[model samples]
Target: MADGVPMVATLAAKTMEVPGVHTLSLALDTHSPFDFDYGQFNMLYLFGAGEVAISIMGWHQGLLQHTIRAVGRVTRPLVALEVGQQLGLRGPFGRGWPLAQLRGRDLVFITAGLGCAPVVAAIHHAVANRDQYGRIVILQGVKHHADLLWQTQYRRWQALGECQVLLAASEEHRHRHHWRLGLVTELLALAEFDADHCAVMMCGPEIMMLAALKQLARLKVADEAVYMSLERNFQCGRGLCGHCQLGPYFVCKDGPVFHYPQVKPWLGREGV
Candidate 1:
């Protein structure tokens, strides 16, 4: 697909219970394949409502899926979309998780809330090549139990012997079973990955990532071995638009995924 061309894709399925969040399965209206690496996002447009960037969740069979939460003018209409509707897609853009470099090493994924959507593909990739990694650990956090997005899928991931999944919620809910009630960083405290041998990939609110980094620091994880997906205001997927600029980089072109050290200098700084 070209950079700016809008490919019309049909909404093949929908899954949701919350008022504003949606998990949509979209298939190319032309019946073509939508291939993308884990961590990349697509620009989705709804005819009159404009577009928004959405992370590529996992694909089921041949349909591409995205977990979208209504947060803006464009997304509000997007979440309200029904099956059989058509929308415009312009990506599979940006860099992805360093899955290739992570082979044979322990893998740790730390995500909060909707952040799980971006890493779902990476989890599947690890499972498909299960022997390539030492141990696979996933730590997820949400505000409340009702905020959890793929409840059953976590079990499927845990079924893989090499993988371990732990969940936490900042605000406790009554239905809690095995879920720990506290900050996500609390799970990090109990995690047992060798900092030197593991590659850590984290995403979520900037604060959550910062908190996780602090905990990882106590564990002695090297700055180079840690990575994060940075979210910025990206207008154009290419570097042309300065909306996604961060210091000397354009998040859309240079990142979305970056090594922790590369962004450390600007972490808490105001207005890069």
Candidate 2:
């Protein structure tokens, strides 16, 4: 089921430094503009080094922006690419933000470290469909004040009055800039909202999500109300590759977004 399309996209523009990460915007030739929800991810292919999943930060004029953190070989070149460069890509794949289903519910979104990418899409989607939901709370954890991404856009989202955001740093000693220091979970304990009325969403480091999930259980949040994404090495663009399989589930097809119960049992299992 791997999507072996072997297609390529043109780099439309590249930005130097985007708040918390580096960004590259690409314009791909397609028959139609693909549809995607906020929390979904696309499988990005690099011919030599292989593939990685990245979220669409924003899109316009047939372009999709991916704000990436330089971590491995494939992404290292991604950060160095100039305008007019060609890049291999295939998909607007994986599950996205639960926009429609979240209607009428107050929402809480939490993220830490590199997890901000996928969550941003959900935030953008919700703000666009503000009439469907109630209050929104955004909680973030980072290493330092400078580590927070998209300050300008984030400030604009905050201005909508539908969202309240915070940044928690792991370090104790701090900066003059306004933000909390510690963990994203700490913000949860301070909030007195009812879990029954809110849907919980998160994107971040494995440990961060693990800690966040543990805390949510204490909050009495229902299993169905909690959600997180999955990531794995994919050899084929389509589901046929089997490299990204988790038992019967294919991260490429079944999900990159799974309800807690679906993946909780496979946490330490091989092929997960």
Candidate 3:
């Protein structure tokens, strides 16, 4: 398929990660494999409901996977799709994490809510090739314990020799042994990573990312060392539509993942 053209994809499998969220495994109609980078997104189009920009969860058994929360017009029907149903897919768009540049550096991953989906593949890649990186620090925040998706996966990462995983639940009343009750940013203090030689990748509500950025700066991490994956109302998948614009760059084309300094001027600013 040509760039920007939607290709037919069959629903291969669907797993419910949480109550309203699901991971959809889609098999493209094309014979060639569908390749995408960590932090890239694809436009999933339903026949009548329209398309929505969903982050590529990862590739599994040659199928493209996407974790979607059914909170919008396209996503609600997308989660309801049965196996064998078909949907339109338009790309593995936008820039991804600069893993090449990050090699040999300690990696710090910070995410809140469902934002982890975009960075999950990168984490997996780093873990799979652990020798290429230094220590791995993973920090996540959720409203409650039950809201934490991929709990088992986090545990597996935690068990790794050089990996540190910290989870926080902001609204939980009862204490969980493995989780702390506070904002995700609070866990930053306990994360084990070399601030001077670590690459920080963060995604979440803008407020949370902003907070994390401030904390990272206080810890002496350079703005150049931090990267962020931003979410926006992406209408066109390409930069033609201005819905996903940030400052002078388009989130869909220039980046869904960007160096902190690239977007610093417009981040958290109102009416951008």
Candidate 4:
């Protein structure tokens, strides 16, 4: 658990979809149990290939799950590894979503593009403790219907009467009945929830999140009640690198998850 020490994690199982997007279910050594709150991420190293930080998709039993999109050097090679291959893992690092504060409040999750990955763990947490909260709403947006991930998982969550899943794709699709066509924020306008008693958690590109924040403000959701996952160029997950700095805070150390008010000053600030 030292700053640079990487623990060996064996690949237990995998679910492959497209070439670059897949889920790797990993098993860490039992003696060195890896436990992390939902929304936290781990630094994954593929031996000599290199390492990259990815959010934990979900966790169950003794396995830790990550949904990886092979976009960069470290990740492109990672998705090709076979099931029994071993890789180095160095975390559970960074701050996570505040699930405790969401108890008894209507919960809304707004995810766009790959932003859905980080919120998957939080969705599982909400589903497992359904009775503890009011209504649960999830709005997902992608460029095309083909970009949707975890459709079956979202269906399971929707089976529960307290939860609802709404998806919006920017482009037209044959499956029109299932999802609306527009920005995800358009669907947000139709959602009926208690604005005063709801907590909103959003993840997406900076532009999408900034636009969503504006819509949330129109709904009267307090800045403190809204949370977001901010991604930056994080080299060292421990915050020593200064690569992921955002104004006065370090994105890797102080957050990947932060309440809106805590980060308002730096959101879209020039050259922070």
Candidate 5:
């Protein structure tokens, strides 16, 4: 893959796990080789349909892996794509969770299901440079045990920081757990969150992040210290398209990740 062309490969791998859901792991090579900030997303093109925003969950060699759960038109084709199917890709875009800037301060992460991908990236960067940050914690929630991706990686990350998680459905297995068993927000009640200099990040549905924001405020954390990954259409990774627009900001440009205080006024309204 040349640095000037998109790798645009066929579906490198796909699988249906007992999470009972069909998930696809795509490996794409891009001409513009780039390093992605933890939580940045890329625009993926599925011929004959449209495009979808996907986060890079893992990357190795020249291949960047995206773990996708089949949901809509773009994703459906992605799920149906065979090992040799081709597709278009651009980005590694969006402002990622800014844990790097908050280095030396306490940090907390709350995510749900696939939302954990970005959170994992932040953790990967943070832990690798642990001396630059303070205490770290993670709380992840998914529909079921199987919906949880990267268990081994999570375990590895857990070894580096204070990690915890929740699973809505626990019917399939049993393990000695430090894992909580409810909504991700519930963990807020148990944490002694430091609002003074600590940063809290939440990524999931808007409602989930909103709830986390409210609780962080109650703990005296300023809105500036609270961040979220807004889930929007994100049709254009370059920010020219308006699908993920929010007033003066473009989620693709301004952020998929933003501090709550920076975006509070624009949440419910429309028109960018």
Candidate 6:
């Protein structure tokens, strides 16, 4: 199949993660295998409703998984889809995390809100191949404790004894013994990783990632050692549409994932 053409896929399963958020498992109609790297996204089409760019969460039993927040025209309907319903899928697009290059080094994952979807698969890969890496530190932040998706997965990773998982709720007045009541960046102080020898993967709102870059710099983490997954108006999965451009690059083509140094100039800019 061509990259631009949408392929038929059936909704095999749906798991509600939180209010307005769902994990959809789609089984492609083709018999051939479908593979995608962590951090890549796919354009899911709903026939008349249009399409939206969603990050690939991973795969299970040959089913493609995407965690979507029902906040838009296409996404709202996509999440509401019932099992056995069919949709169109185009691509396992964009660049992905450099997990191969960072082998033997510590991994520090920083994410906020629903942006964690793009990095979740990478974390799972690291955990499954634990001996190949140094330390695994996961930090996530949400507006409320209940807003934290995959709460059970985070707890399971924490129980691994080697992985460090820290969560922060910025708007919560009440405290849970397992959660810190502050910004996710605050949890960085308590996270254990070698800043100089670790690779950092970050996703979320532009403001949040920018703030994290500053914190990482203070800890002597080189800009080259960090990578980020960026979001933009990806109307088309290909760069020809120009909807997802950032300076000379297109988020849908050049990257949804890029090394920190590659996008430093436009990170927090008002307009690109």
The residue pairs found clashing in candidate 5 are 3-31, 5-31, 7-29, 7-30, 10-85
Q: Which ten residues in a row have the lowest lDDT in candidate 4?
A: 172-181
Q: Write one digit per residue (lDDT tens) for candidate 6, span 1-272.
A: 79889999999999999989999999999988888899999999999899999999999899999999999789999998999999999998999999999999999999999989999999999999999999999999999889989988998998997799889999982365558998888888888999889999999998888888888889889999999999999888888899988988999999999998999988777878
Q: Model 1: which ten-residue window has the lowest total lDDT?
A: 172-181
Error of 2 at 185 (Å): 1.4
Worst 10 residues of 2 by lDDT: 172-181
Q: Is candidate 3 or candidate 4 better by lDDT?
A: 3
Off by over 4 Å in 2: 18-20, 172-178, 268-272
Summarize candidate 2's per-residue lDDT along 73-106 as a digit string, tens digits.
7787777778898877777677766667878887
The most accurate candidate by lDDT is 3
- After superposing candidate 5, which stretches have Cα over 4 Å from the reference? 1-7, 15-32, 161-176, 269-272
lDDT of 1 by residue, 82-115 (tens): 8999999988899999899988889999999888
How many steric overlaps does candidate 6 have?
A: 0
The C-alpha TM-scores of every prediction are 0.95, 0.89, 0.98, 0.96, 0.84, 0.98
lDDT of 6 at 77: 91
Q: Sorted on lDDT, highest at the top, how do the candidates line up?
A: 3, 6, 4, 1, 2, 5
Which residue runs does candidate 1 get wrong by more than 4 Å? 173-177
1-272: candidate 3 lDDT, tens digit per residue: 67678999999999999999999999998889878889999999999999999999899888999999999889999999999999999998999999988999999999999999999999999999999999999999999889989989998998899899899999992365558999999999888889989999998999999999889989999999999999999999889979988889999999999999999999988998
Query: How many residue pairs clash in all the candidates, one count each?
Result: 0, 11, 0, 0, 5, 0
Quote the lDDT for 79 in model 2: 72
Local accuracy of candidate 5 as per-residue lDDT tens digits, 131-211: 887777777766666667777766776565444333332334235364656666777777644668788877887777777
lDDT of 1: 0.86
